[model samples]
Target chain A: MRLELKEVASGYGHRTLIRRISLVVTDGEVLCLLGPNGSGKTTLFKTILGLIRLQGGQILLDGEDISRWPRARLARVMGYIPQAHNPPFPYRVLDVVLMGRTAHLGPTAAPGREDMAVARRAINTLNISHLEDRIYTEISGGERQLVLIARALAQEPRLLIMDEATSALDFGNQLLVLSHIKRLAQMGLAIIMASHFPDHALLYASKVMLLKKGQVYSLGRPEEMVTEENLKSLYGVDVKIIRAELPGCNETRVCVPVCR
Target chain B: MAVARKQGSLTNSLATAEGNYRWREIALTALPLLVFLFSFPLGRYPISPGQLLTILAAKVFPIAPTWPATLETVVFQVRLPRMLAAMLVGAALATAGAAYQGMFKNPLVSPDILGASAGAGFGAALAIYFSLGVVGIQVSSFLFGLLAVGLTWALSSRIRHDPVLILVLAGILMGTLFSSGTSLIKYVADPYDKLPAITFWLMGSLAAIAPRDVWTALVPILVGTLPLYLLRWRLNVLSLGEEEARSLGLDTGRLRLIVILCSTLITAASVAISGMIGWVGLIIPHLARMLVGPNYRELLPAAILIGSAYLLLVDDLARVLTSVEIPLGILTSIIGAPFFLYLLLNARRGWV
Candidate 1:
């Protein structure tokens, strides 16, 4: 499935945060949206999920307008992980993940043998099966992030939308999550992620959309979009980029931004 | 695909486990009901349990029946209504308490937090001062209880964008306001006669319930409670948080309104019938949650059954343990507060 945002304008009432935004996320690819702080990445995500009403234009899933899709249907088709949502209760990790099966279960249907199996497999795939019985509130921040990603994966969505999912993670956890997401893209799930890290985009993204002040500043392959000129323009800093050889790919480098 | 198979097996195992656990829950619920029904026969009136059962059965299905002594009339006319009133009020308060806790997603929240208790107290106090009859007190109780809930709802609505904080603040504010009004009413009442009457009503007793009062209160409670019973799944979704509930295609705004209305009605009706019973509402739901997981379908019914059983046992203790009938409120707080503390410290592992 392909997601097309054509001239989509949205915001809080009377306050247009994102104006005339347009982008595309095709199947079997990872499109990373890189932006500076307060650049409306979260707002763009909310608009796409129909949490915020669009002031103008439309969003299309495949060939149909998605604005009319019910939220339950939308949740089934597009798995969303919103940065870090703290559940008020101390739910078990497995219970949290099973919520993803809401779209599949009937109203009165108890969690059947099938639902539990799916949850365990998602946990195993994320390498967090040991955390299943652990209280979600008791887990560390990185482990919680992995569990949340595992929850989204359990939805079996065709499209995955993540809003700054790794912003609170440690460096190692961030890399681990990005690699897992990259692997999911290889498995044919369309992934759209918002990130503050340019290197993460440069490393795992097949395509990049650079959002500056809620507008699409540029969009293209990561190699062509992550130039020092674009980074300087988006973040207002001079960044030194060094090319290095990684274990498997030539697309390895380091970005050291020198604040001026 | 692997994930799907894993979730499938986990849910399957849980279902079978739940099936077994469910039978145990039913047994726990049934034990209390049986004991309570049997208690009615063992009281001051020496109607044998077998004879009481025969009498009750004859009332329902009469082919030919034998009547007992005049004391049987005393049991049926005097004690039965009061006992049923206590059990029903207890069940109503506990059910509403569980609903509020789930709706707010806060285990600590109770129906009384909305000023309904204080409002009912004030109304009952006013009715006593006016020397209202049984009918007058019932009307006044319903009116003032509804008034308090309406005031709390209005105050909370002003800051609708942040409902939880607004709800807490509104409840506290209204509770304080109504309590002060009750104090003022107490001061003005004739200290010798009306003061004692007001104080007794405030302390809460089910000793004076008439059949008419029972029918009046029970109707509204059942009317309010049935909808909550039916919408338990929606309540489960609500516990996840308002944002998540909306995302799951539930009209959270409407659901919240319905829950609040039902709970307020149940609280008011129970208060009218039995004065101002506390602790049962606040504590029973937590105990129910501990016994079963936080699943609302299981939790709500369990809370109701356990609450009815508990109040019956407590009332029996209040009567049989001493010649004097202790205020049900005083007895419950004495037992409930300490038990609540124990649960708070020891049961944190199971709580979410």
Candidate 2:
């Protein structure tokens, strides 16, 4: 196991935003958090990543207490890409990816040839090598998200935490980013991403975590957790469950949210 | 086994990064050194290149004891310290400007636009209004300049989490208030002696710089500059807004505080000595950004080199134009304002 959050509770300034959230992500696992707009999904990621103070409970990484880890040490172990990464100045796409190596960089140490090579490889992995020298701000939203994922890849972390990283992408770009995430997990990374779409969670994730009202509503396999009843309860809309097979794999479709 | 594989890959990547970065550092440092060395021989008192080299060698090395008195005086007493001081102050202001722009995440930000220069002028003007002697003027100007910056900082930061717009607005408001007070002081001063002194001081000239003033200015400037070098990379990350910087393991509040403190002190210290020399801080960093991209590690040093070259080239023109020493602000404004307009019109959108 790479990351395990045990009964974790956290919030901002005396307000308890998320509570009793327990989950474990093993290597090669894609665990997606499904919730509505105010369902504390982002807060859960922040608590696990230690961006906000954890009010209660323990977060352990490889059996070490995550609370005790210094931020730089935590960064080396786990990489995070927030939903919105706005750049005030126009940095080249390659430069943005190279920033992932910052945790490894020393006080006066420079970004070297190897760092560029890794950045290049990550960009290639995301099929964004052609956009390497383009201005980050000028690129389309989908391209920026891929570049940011490449940045996360450059960190070479055991666990990746993404908060709505694919929310800005179109339908096809959304699938592309999730497939990239699936590939990273297949390569032994533990991914915990907060996403609004339950369909995507069911499509690619090995595990699904349902958060409701600052608590974990359910945590288990996506096959059992993403049922028609669970979708209706979580999203307060009736959902129809359907199963189909794609050319290469099985597909589980929950169609009630689409009806109305 | 997986940990071993990952560790091996990480090290391989790191080693490559280190190698590339080292060459860039060498190139950056070397180019600036060569340019700084060559700038010294360019002025009209133009020692023959050979004589200039000979004079430099004699001073730096003990083997050559005999040197011409006039050459020695021109190189050591007259030109050397002035040139070195110009280089140091230019580097200080431009680097500080780059740091300030990064901290604020605004390309238009400059060292003096925050009101440090206006405050320094007001402080110096107050000293003149009292008819204080030379010692009195320098001391009061230095102290009041510091005080004005302190006031601006306090006012801007009064409400924790003040927006950048609010901070900028406060600086502008404070700057206008101080400038008006200075105008009032100028109006009341005696027209004959005090008025001309104030006018010339406001216009800014390096003609009166002495070796002693250089030493006095060096202490605060260097003290403020060291922190910037240590924090250069962090400043680059800081340009991505406060929340992202914090999540990346940087103490954004502390880093911002340290940067604001250092850049403000450096600006106030330089303005205290140089008397509101404009555009070296404002324009040079923009040119550096255009040349080297927004990465502060490269941009900072580039700004230093280009800024020194700029001020020295312009100062050289100022001296050769007439027997009357032209105010540096007038010269820099004439040169920088047009170039800035050209950049605004020509640069690609979002490049800044």
Candidate number of the best lDDT: 1
Q: Give the per-residue Cα lDDT of candidate 2 at B99.
A: 90
- In model 2, the runs with Cα more than 4 Å from the true position are A6-9, A14-16, A62-64, A84-86, A113-121, A127-135, A227-238, A256-260, B1-78, B131-136, B145-158, B162-196
What Cα-based lDDT does every candidate model obtain? 0.82, 0.79
lDDT of 2 by residue, A183-206 (tens): 988888889888888777878889
Candidate DockQ scores, in order: 0.34, 0.32
Q: Write the per-residue lDDT of candidate 2 for residues B240-325, one digit (tens) a residue.
A: 77656655656666777788778777887777666778877878888877767788877887887788777777777666677677
CA RMSD of all predictions:
4.0, 5.7
Per-prediction backbone clash count: 21, 7
**Model 2 docking category:** acceptable
- Report the lDDT of model 2 for residue A197: 82
